[model samples]
Target: MSRWRTALVTGASSGIGREIARQAAARGVDVVAVARREDELRTLAREVRDTWGRTVEVLPADLLTAGGLAAVEARLADPDRPVDLLVNNAGFGSLGWFHELPIDREDRQIRLNVLAVTRLASAALAAMVPRGRGGVLNVSSVSGFQPMPTNAVYGASKAFVTSLSQALHEEVRGAGVHVTALCPGFTRTEFQAVAGSDVRSLPPWVWMTSAAVARAGLDAVTRNRAVCVPGAGYRAVATVVDLAPRDVVRRLTALATRASLPAPEAGR
Candidate 1:
């Protein structure tokens, strides 16, 4: 991995983030795990140390908050313990109607998913580009490829990540910095529960493991692929969507989103 031995993974307490951190450690990369759960982060650190004998720093901070975001940004720009790779993976979604969801929840989603990714990526690149080697893998989603009516905020946030990552990939290529966006479809993660969606209700084949997605992302980073949609099904879907007409895509997406969304409770 060379100088890409150290990586900082956000949302590292569970699901895709946890698996990504584990995979990085398995590859001999030291990891810094960031999340709001102090206990979870500490446990992950211990697991990494015992299982892979790798260094793991536990950063217990909610990236949606200004203090937490600024603290992480400062760490990224730190000269003494420079981070070689950045995985901007912390994010959440609400499955209810956009109008029905709390304003603060929606706002926090944008803060963590979009704002934090932008700031951290910029911080990492500022350090990496000058010295000429590092990588940033933003964990986007397949929802980013098209408009999703029910998952509007979540999909839009991921679109921002995908677009930002691709542009940054080109911008930093000359400086030997790798930037990639991993746009995975439904993966087995806490994201489903938190988002108020049930993947078990969907087809089994539609879901991939967190490990698989994270592994594909790291591979893309190492190979310098700007975008990667893991799993064959997702790849094919993305390809078809890429070639499909805009109006058709929008109609199909709206129908699918409406169908997939769970119905609201009775007296609410």
Candidate 2:
């Protein structure tokens, strides 16, 4: 059983975030599911309630705006509705050369992927530390461990998440709070479609389900583990990237990423 009682999950409408919410509710935790899609969030809340018999409150807001982000911060900062688990799972990527893609698009990606993660994590920790119990899970990617040529900005954002999560994990270990970065490789999600990449082009062996990734993240954070790359293959790959020659890793990553990856579709 998880020590957490209530959780606030960004991007809880679908994919890995939704899975995490379900898993948390299964362990008897109340959930506040945040996402831009109001309908999807409502549906998920209903499913969680019906399936796990746990309460799920849906909050629809875009983290890109100051108002939307502020509302979430206030909720986390509120002592009355204290959230013991925080999952920063809301993020998207653009697949293209850094210079070729619209600079504004990359900036939005950073704002949501990096800035939002930083601010929300801060809010969660500020409250969690005082209470002396809580956990923060930041959903990152395997690309954080290596350079991704086609998706440079997205990779950079994940790197920030991975680095920050590891540092924060150590910083708050004695404070009775856990911070974990969940670095998952390719999974069966709408992420690829939205990013304008075809999932079928990638090797089947590299794919894992969102449910599997969510389970790994929840387990790791509960155990106070700092970093978790879910799949066996990806774990081995991450280990090699950390130990291997930087030049070799760079060349290999660029080559692999470029082969299966296409530039993001126009206006995507």
Candidate 3:
């Protein structure tokens, strides 16, 4: 029998997800890190094993495919694999106005960010409910609070995550299973590169480190917080949005998005 608690973190190959896995392992938790990159996942597993002397399992799955989700389901259902923590953090971003973006990419983004989180949450909760103790961390974003002109679909998907986490937190309140929505703003990660965020365009003060974000999320789960806003700056922004008029928030976010990730150049 594994003595350490078992945590399953999706998108564990990099960014906030990878940091979460490392943090959990350091705290004496065995981890099952899932990602599409098999090589990176294996490397992370080895590193975690070496540093923490904890059991590390690498399960490479796309999370955007039915086959990938099925693999996750199988592992969750396996009697021997009892997940004490579940981190739903696999997602990506595509920049541009919604109409101008490729429809296929938008479809993939929705499938990965929204559908995958819902399916994985169901699987994790199904097992955890029976055991009467567990934690689920949904990686949402500040973008979820308002319309994002450059990342509309991505924002919508994160909104779904935030909503789902809150509902689940209430539903399982007394069941010993806590659910937390980790709403992080700009974290220093490959996400900006993928989203094509122009460094010169945004304020430098908005960014948070991956390790700090991971720590805040883990702490939230342990304390059973329904929503975990990692950075003070982000929390303040969220507060402002909540207090401001809806239209005002909408316009501001739209303008910010437009400025951050501009459309591709006209000619190659």
* Better by lDDT, candidate 3 or 2: 2
The lDDT for every candidate, in the order shown, is 0.90, 0.92, 0.88
Clash pairs (backbone) in predicted model 3 = none
The residue-by-residue lDDT of candidate 2 on 75-146, one tens digit each, is 999999999999999999988767688899899999999999999999999999999999999999998997
Q: Give TM per candidate.
A: 0.96, 0.96, 0.94
lDDT of 1 by residue, 1-268 (tens): 4347899999999999999999999999999889999899899889999999999998888897889999899889998998989999999887767777788888988988899999999999999998788999999999899987888899899999999999999998778899999999988889988988866678789889998998998999989999999999899999999999989999998877778766655544
Instruction: Compose the digit string of candidate 3's lDDT tens values, residues 1-268.
Output: 3222888999999999999999999999999989999999999988988898987798999888889999997787677868888999988988776777899999999998899999999998998988898889999998888877778899899889999999999999999898999999989889978766566656789789999999999999899999999988889889998899999988887676566654556631
The pairs that clash in candidate 2 are none
Task: Report the CA-based lDDT of candidate 2 relative to the real structure.
Answer: 0.92
Q: Which residue pairs of candidate 1 clash?
A: none
Better of 1 and 2 by lDDT: 2
Which prediction has more favorable TM-score, 1 or 3?
Answer: 1
For model 1, the stretches where C-alpha displacement exceeds 4 angstroms are 1-3, 262-268
What ranking emerges by lDDT with the best candidate at the front?
Answer: 2, 1, 3
